[model samples]
Target: MQEISYKQKVLKEAKRQGIISCWFFLANFAASFLIAVYKAFTQPHTLKQLQNLELIDSVITNLTTLAATIYIWLAIKKLADIYDTDVYEIFIKAVIAVVLAIFLLLALGLEGITPGAVKAVSYVLVGIGIYFFILWFKLNFALAKITNNKLFKTYVFFAIISAVVGGAIKTLAMFGFFEGGVYMLAAALSIAILYVLPTAFYLYAWTMIKEE
Candidate 1:
């Protein structure tokens, strides 16, 4: 009975995390769009206003990302405990590494270090992103197995597809295969699909867990 209760708690946490994650993506996208619009229409005399708009966009994205990260960490920790897995340990290490990497980049920027060091940080960030993808894939795979919900496994493929499609569209646009408006529409749709599909699968996985 205790195990069942704990599992239910984790499922609820996972569901809440999924919703927050979706909001993070959507809010960031909206913020970016607004910034772009502001830049396009703002007069040169409004330089301060443009700077403020960008600052607000940055703050919104950062706060939502932080909130999503916290919930994600909590859900992963609880799920790891229930499943007797150490994936959460990897997550903890990755979080630390990311913080250190960011700090190093900021310090280098302030010290006017060579661009090489900045490039190195960019590489580190890419590696950290891959670590996150691996962790996400493994966790969802485990959930798929335990809940017998194959929807959980589909998110990984959707994520890959979105990346590929988005890249292809951007490349084609660069070569004039698409008009500006067409490229923008395609980009927006791809991003929307990317965030929405994985979130839908995550929510469905939680529903399966609830049914179990």
Candidate 2:
């Protein structure tokens, strides 16, 4: 039997780990959804009205955000296992990527270009640009440590894939794909599902592409 290369082994492990992490996220999302629904019923207002309750809304949002962050951290840790790299190092890199992205966005405002262009571009640049940077940083750093491939190239590949998935979701929401009282509930559910789906896909693709 031909011996599999270390890179291949790492890729295979990453894929398996990624898929497992996705399942964890799915479970968390389900739990969060149930909590959201229970809260909706217990509260004295409609869902839209509940959204205006800053304290309650903040609590719910923070829980969801924490779930997402933990999911990413776990995925990175799994990738680090395959790559033989320090998980802390990967995490630190992820943090740096986020900080740099924020600085860049701040710089954009400082440059004082037209207010109109800034208003339009700021959202896209800050929103999508920061997200891609984080994805690229994690994907490339983990992949390079495992595969001896160029980090930038792997980052580019991951960034493109992540961007397309994110853009599609945003486009759907912007077009009023879910509108109405009942539809608002449906929209909230859809948003939660959409959020989970990309993470699921990324995990699956990473497993498939990385040499096992």
Highest-TM-score candidate:
1
Tens digits of per-residue lDDT for model 2, 19-118: 5655655666565666567665676777686665655646666565566566556656655655556654756666666666666578666765788767
Clashes of each: 0, 5
Q: Name the lDDT value of residue 209 in candidate 1.
A: 55
Best by lDDT: 1
- TM-scores for the candidates: 0.76, 0.45
Report the lDDT tens digits of candidate 1 across residue range 1-212: 99788787776776577656656665666777767655655557477887788788889889977876787687667667777666577668767867876786677667667788778878877787777677667766766775566877886777778678767776766788766567667656655555555556555555555533
lDDT of 1 at 33: 71
